[model samples]
Target: MGLHPIHTSKSYHDKDELGPEGNEFTSREEVFDYDFYKKLASDPKVLAIGECGLDYYRLEPETAAKQKESFIAQIELALELGKPLMLHIRNAYGEALEILRARPGARGDVHFFAGTWDEAREFLDLGFTLSFTGVITFARDYDEIIRNTPLDMILSETDCPYVAPAPFRGKRNEPSYVSEVVKKIAEIKNLDFEICRTALLQNALSFANIH
Candidate 1:
């Protein structure tokens, strides 16, 4: 299995101690350092350079700009190393898409995507895959986005230790929970569970560049 890094400024220590609010503990210094990623990229198990992207929800303008810079730097690294990217965009899809369209040799998924149909189409047009998480299973509003998105452009992730599906709502998520996402997509698109699972497995493999 290919392993992808979920880049964030929050320290794992802080996450372990404080939870999501612990994200507030993240320092600007920790967020902008490319040298850290250089060391991480050297690891053989690290397949991609991200879950890095902009988060306008909590960051100040300057901090958000720094996040964008770090994201671009990672994009460059992915280009140089010929690896795919794993993006985490929240409330900054426009900015993320702008940067992505401007850069060449950058490829990856926009994980846990919560954008509109037009926005989704834009990303698809730019050749990026859109990954859905367990949110789609419960969020009534996401039905249209789930239904409209083509199967080829669809990918599923648990975003584990995070967004868990129904019946397990408000619980810590794990990679095994990816099955829930698969089931939801199958229901939304009126597809067979096995077919959806196989197709998504293929999509995930292709996006990660695994032969």
Candidate 2:
């Protein structure tokens, strides 16, 4: 039941304030530097390369450029290291898809995915796994996305400290809440809970290269 923490700037700052074990990425800039990822990847505990990708929703145009640069760099690093990627995409799915298509053989999961069925299908076609957080349990739109995607391609996550599920909505999320996410996915996919759980567990293991 190990949790692989996704590193982000806010999480880094929070960890710094709390003085706890937390993964951190300074900015999109650091994501592209091979030396930085190489250093981080040296640690056996760091299993994946990112939560790295485009986020046109929140970023300014110039800043988004940096994000794309970082995203591409991290993708390259994942390929070089033979490690899976933890992608974070927002309103930039098309751009992300373009880059992914350009780089053949790059594999990863798009964490906390929010996109249309068509877009989801494109990702599936690209052979990338799609992960969803608790948002799908409460948001009608997200639930639709969950229902549309196939069970085998789906994975569950908490995106802790962010999108907590229904019962714990508005509370700080944690890895333990991944169960709620799993439950929601099971409901949407109309599959048995245990079966969904096993499949997601296998997907996680395979993505992280953990036998």
Candidate 3:
């Protein structure tokens, strides 16, 4: 069986009416739940402490500061708890890299990573893995990076209800489509599909330190 219940905490940005039964983080303190996340992540089943990181896409000065604060707080929590992070970075890899550099031994999977080779290498150097998403199925930008990234340092994700793979584009994504992502990775790396699939599963297990 594949990994399940991969719990994560707040991201830098969130949608309106975002959670079940209308429950949501209603304030800056609640949204950037550093203390709460540390407690949540301390659970043995909560393998990582994220879906959290910097997002400079809109680039608001005030919002960016809050994002940084939340990001760094989560980094500290993950480092202290000895848990891997599940990062969500966009247009902020350089800044994220600098922050990570300051925190040695901080390691995690860069979810839906679409960074340049130099950026990817910087994270890789810091022992982070680049997780590819359904974007690779429709875009060619990620091809070279996948080819260059070490198999053991690579991961697959659906990023579901968002970037659904080709042939499923415009449809809400589900975890079942992750196989398409692994197949694309296998194609890019010129490895057999099953071999690539097994390797990715093992990579996730090891990265999260799950037995």
Per-candidate RMSD, Å: 4.1, 5.5, 5.5
What lDDT score is found at residue 98 in candidate 1?
93
Candidate 2 local lDDT, 131-193, one digit each (tens): 988777787787777777777788888877776788987677789999998998888778899
* Candidate 3 residue lDDT tens string, 114-162: 7899999999999999999888988999899999999999999987767
Residue 79 shift from truth in candidate 2, angstroms: 0.9
Q: Please report how far candidate 1 places residue 127 from its true position, in Å.
A: 0.8
Give the top-scoring candidate (TM-score): 3
Indicate the residue-level lDDT of 116 in model 2: 85
Residues 1-211, model 1: lDDT tens digits: 1212223444223555324423434432455456666777867677777778876665554566567777888888888777778887878889989999999668888888988888888888888889998888888777788788889889998877776787688677778988999999999999999999999999988987788
State which candidate has the highest lDDT. 3
Least accurate 10 contiguous residues by lDDT in model 1: 1-10
> What's the ranking of the predictions by lDDT, best on top?
3, 1, 2
RMSD of model 1 against the true structure = 4.1
Better of 2 and 3 by lDDT: 3
Which regions of candidate 2 are displaced past 4 Å? 1-31
Count of steric clashes across candidates, in order: 1, 0, 0
